[model samples]
Target: MSNIKSSKKHAIQSKKNNQFNKSRKSLLRTLIKKVDIAIIQKNKILAQESWKILQPILDRFATKKIIHKNKASRCKSRLYLKIKKIP
Candidate 1:
């Protein structure tokens, strides 16, 4: 679907970028799950640690455009709220 030589190169670049982004997104999800599991288990310390790990990953994903800026904000907000609810 590329029209020019540069476009073709761009296509390849995009593919590589997609692979990286996908991995990043997957890792973020896993980190979020760890946080959620901690919250659900009422492990406040672990939840805090997971949040520390997840925040930058969320920012990185937003920066890289794999996920929307607002989505990251929403997720972070919800995660914090859940953490607050934990004992």
Candidate 2:
């Protein structure tokens, strides 16, 4: 219910951005979960592979400001630790 034309456009753009961000976040969570599941299953090879895939995706999200850099680093650290302990 935006009255102004610019406001209407902004609303539409906001909705698109919101959807995009949500999908990205969901994908990030899924990637993390894949690594977690691999770790839980004690599959070291799979865990390592998933972790390798996850690290750059996390860094990209951090770079895009979708997620905090510290959070990304912390997650990477924890995942790496878990992978190391899998042996």
Candidate 3:
């Protein structure tokens, strides 16, 4: 509850932004999990496809600051290595 008009507007904007960010983060996590599941199943083609889909989404999120750039890079590196290890 904000008394000032500007404060109320800010509060509303904050709430909307919070929800938007939460949904984006959830989508990012789901994409990451899809890649991880493919890797765990040892399906190289599926893993590669999933990685192709996820990598750009991850970079986009990182650019938007939904997640840290380093975290996104680390996840990409680790997942790529796992995919490569699959024969």
Q: Relative to the true structure, how large is the alpha-carbon lDDT of every model? A: 0.92, 0.95, 0.93
For model 3, residues 5-83, the per-residue Cα lDDT tens digits are: 9999999999999999999999988988998898888999999999999999999999999889999999999999999
- Cα lDDT tens digits, model 1, 2-87, are 68999999999999998988888888889999999999899999999999999998998898789999999999999999999887
Q: Which candidate's lDDT is highest? A: 2
- Return the clash pairs for model 2, or none: none
The candidate 3 region of ten consecutive residues with least summed lDDT is 31-40
All candidates in order of TM-score, best leading = 3, 2, 1
Cα lDDT tens digits, model 2, 28-85, are: 9999999999999999999999988999999999999889999999999999998999
Error of 1 at 25 (Å): 0.5
Which residue ranges in model 2 land beyond 4 Å of their true spot? none
Q: What is the lDDT of residue 25 in candidate 2?
A: 95
* lDDT against true structure, model 1: 0.92
* Order of models, best lDDT first: 2, 3, 1
Looking at model 2, residue 44 earns an lDDT score of 97
Q: Stretches of candidate 1 above 4 Å error? A: 1-3
